[model samples]
Target: MTVTATLAGLDPTTLGDALRVAGSPGFDRWQDQIRRTGGCSDPIHLTGTTVTRDRDTGQVLHSYSTEAEPGGRLRVACGNRRASRCPSCAWTYAGDTYHLIRAGLTGDPAKGTPHTVRNHPRVFATLTAPSFGPVHNRPGRGHRPCRCGIHHPADAPELGTALDPAAYDYAGAVLWNNHAGHLWRYVTIYLPRELAKCAGITQRELRERLRISYGKVAEYQKRGAIHFHAVIRLDGPDGPDTAPPAWATRDLLTNALRTAAARAEVALPAVGDQPARVLRWGTQLDVQAIGAFGHGEDLTEQAVASYVAKYATKAAEATGTVDRRIGELSELDKLPDLPDHTRRLIRACRDLDALYPDRKLWQWAHMLGFRGHFSTKSRRYSTTLGALRQVRADYRAAQQRAALGLPDPDDHPEATTLTLAHWAYAGHGHTPGESWLAATIARDIQHNRDTAREHRAALDTAGEW
Candidate 1:
């Protein structure tokens, strides 16, 4: 068959481009690059040269350049943590988050946490934003009608929409999202003081005797407000490596968290016509002890870790908003399908930005004015995301070194090697055909992961039996 005939069924625009790529000698190399990035949807293209040499003798240890790669550029994962932006990178990020949280709850010797942490007083606490106004909701078990007087279906588009849009406090809701991070900081400060009160000691004495460590992830409620789910732990003064003092009990930790959350508040000065406001956590505080293993009415360590990791890859997009920054109010007009409630919230951000320029509300209007990391942890909570990423990078580097027959860095402890590299961003993303292939690779990789996980789970179940 003729080449044109063979390509007839393919997408018209990408067919010629696909043919050109497939006919090229660098086709395999391009595919290899995509595979190396785990098929990132928007891989960054970089042009660079790197050289590793012995410091003293200046002996060349390794040399590499992107000039030999496909199109004389190297493609790397963008490492975006938002699943709406890049699922492959987000999946990797979620895995790292899971391990980081798990290590804190159950401990991991490799991550510098001792198993004794499982015995530490740990609680899974959820801090929610106060109600701006009543909204449509499914009172799941109670079978009660919404305040607006209707039973909404599970998939109703209006579920989270305001029952009375005109009366809803859009300004307050967005402002709360903007100051959510600040409110969390207040909680941290008050938490220690509350702990001191529970132990019948002064704040100064509490610092020397005990420490509070936690890993928290911010989640967007359907109503576009930010809420926090955290695994709060009480550790000895030295951290997870040491056991907490006798006075530090699980009940003590839970009570302290409840009191701290109640007392935590952020006072915002009046901006223009906007009135002064004090933001505090919602009254619906949920604090539950984390069990070492799954049991009746107790959250398991693994369950809590998985729950936090799941949200780590999400953002305000969960509230039916755009995943990227809203360039201007005009952009909102272009999205005809955007929920009216969400549109009003975006408008609130744009309007507030004029008075509160420092908050950069307009710049983050897409996020409903939230401008904080979705996931965060205290210093002694567990290993950091950076540490987890570095471990993966080091492992990959070691594998590459082994493949190239290079000596391990540990082998030449006294002989230091210096690396010099310069990289310039060329571009990003892929052509239509390349995107199709990359998506296929991503699906295959995910499938492999799922299969491996299921196999291990089956083995564990059998062992339990």
Candidate 2:
């Protein structure tokens, strides 16, 4: 129990290294940060090379190498797939996502506005998955009839369930999810034609008069259905299109969407006894104007931006599924306590893996049967995660310089200064004491978010900025 007793048989250099990493001033804050990070839980620690050029001459004057950090270990914040994984990093990601989406809609990088975007008609839309076979679901008010003619209990386990499991169309639901992106693309493409027709304009000429701009995200409903929520905007040529037709109302956009969803369907390759598959949006597609005045369930630019950003960090595992990068097929049957539906999804992805051997679905076997990008957007929609990461990198680098008392804008390209670094993944995760700290750090972040939400709620109530 005594210090000497614990160190009695330890190697001197190894013990000294331990003491330094654990107790040195340089590592105290870092250790605290690591403890806060909870082993980064899902940190994306990266090691890479940066090549910078002279602003005027465009000559490659400087290259900062991290190839030598311990084990070549470079302690970059792990970009997480879930907020639950790392709040500090996720929060930063979420904030960056917000601004990225916001800038696309509002067009102001600093204040997240285009000044002209507000003049456009924008709506937040949510389209949910069709019933696979109802599991439990949130209660509804003033409920509609269940075509089955039986009133299901508000908390009843029968909601969203297909009356017959054998005929429940699970294949369609899964495939719908798999091809949902394609269906969405079809809609995006079709909308222009429909809008043009409705507006008495040619498809090619549609852009001359108006444009459709949107940002959307997919979410899972409890019964294993993938639904989408979107922010749809009607803009002009330069985005948030300047000239609006008298017909460019929220009602018009909603009408165009409804019509498209009804008719939009894509034929995917067939499987099992199932006939050729035709993928489509769920039977229930809700498009409402986003506003507080009950104008249209106003998906305000800010609210929609934030809402979509929140879902950006989630992975399939959050829904009791896996991330799908399985080491082997045999591993699928051994995923501990996974639910049947999730297990089925994983198998499906494994099967689909044969179709796109390059994507390696079997490799990502934990992600169920789907192997597609989780969140993506059109280039014009906004900034990117990479861009956001760069901003933070620049900020942190500046801070590092400030700490060393380097000159402001340390833009020097001098390569006279030699560099040496080396690091290995000293094995991920924390000692018990560090785990304790990581939890504390996460709690602090959640608390801050809650407090900020409360402040915003108060502001909304008072109608003040």
Candidate 3:
């Protein structure tokens, strides 16, 4: 009666009646969710029927009739969060990604890695895009002169600003960003080889005694360039959770990085079948020793972990991959600060999108036709995003069950089984109201993380106490 009354044309009088009957508990639950998290900018409202079967016997013994659920439909979250695309969902995803990256770095996969693997020499290394013709820069790494006489200011927005916009190689950068995954895949193969060469062992033999375990995140530079920041560690074949070989010092790892960055290269099909494009990492490569806290000037392990985690949730959209599709050359015009090279790459992505519609590239059309996962890791590189997420879910479920005071929570079976759900997108984004709630929640979350960082820092400084 209460639920039905609330649905009576959504009038204030009826709403008051429903609230009085249903009480404040249920209302608070709904309101809290509305304020804290959103599924997407505009979530896909769904209407559907679902049934779970006994995999063993293929028998359906229960069902939740739509008559029983909210308007015979469920309010499900749309899972996208790009403010430009799906702000609501993007927020959720970004946070999840940060946790995932942090979990790997801290060896706290899921419930957490109480294990000792957290202390490895895990450094966050960044590899950047090279000169695709002169761009306005601060003039030098050490303050050398550019071909132009102007010495760019330290805060100059023009740094990486193209001197000759017409001559800018946007195409090259776009293709490079697209192929970066492959380039990374190549790095996975070559960096180890470089390490092996340094150790005076064949790649295979080197593997028998030592292993390079790493987790990496890719980020987009303000200049529309893609750079990779990774947590690299050399462990005995067993990897983190185990001590590395004595030979696997940070110095040796750094040296191997230098050799690998210079030697790694791959070739992609040339534009318009003209020729082949040789691909490799950018000239700017950085490696730092990540070890015990405060031992060096490099990024700390925990800080690096948090950094990688931060980018885990970003999409090409964050760096501005709108439209996810391009109909013609003019579409590129709508984009700002995009180099001609990048524009050409966007055009190429559109072209390739047709060649492989199976890839659902148009869905990522804003990414300029690349469909590869933006961030990935080697199979053996600690816990995975999936595993970490599952653990968190399990923990959360346990907490909920505990709150309910349910006995043997994991084994509890729903006595009744029947559900019908239907929901249509009212649309996404904060309706000023929801937006205020989300922002407030986001601020709270940020503070909580800052607190955690400080706590961890205190613990590190106090060590073994």
Report the alpha-carbon TM-score of model 2 versus the true structure.
0.74
List candidate 1 stretches off by more than 4 Å.
Answer: 1-11, 54-61, 294-297, 414-416
TM-score of each: 0.94, 0.74, 0.71
Report the C-alpha lDDT of model 1 over 385-423, residue by residue, as the tens digit: 999999999999989888877678787678677889999
lDDT of 2 by residue, 194-267 (tens): 78777777887888777787777777665566777787778776654264666788888888888877777887
* Residue 257 lDDT in candidate 1: 84
In what order do the candidates fall by lDDT, top score first?
A: 1, 2, 3
Candidate 1 achieves a global lDDT of 0.89
Q: Model 3, range 1-465, lDDT digits (tens) per residue?
A: 114332455456544544453454444543444433432334333345555344445556433333343333334456653445555555556666666556555566433343465655555689876666676665446377656677666655555556786776655666666667777777777788988888898988887877777667777664556778877766667765566677777777888877777776767665454357786787778877665545774566557766765666565543344534566657667678655444554665566555444545445556654456656766656666666557667786567546644333247564333323344444333333333333444456557767997998799788842
Among the numbered candidates, top lDDT falls to 1
Instruction: Judge candidate 3 at residue 121 and give its lDDT.
Output: 50
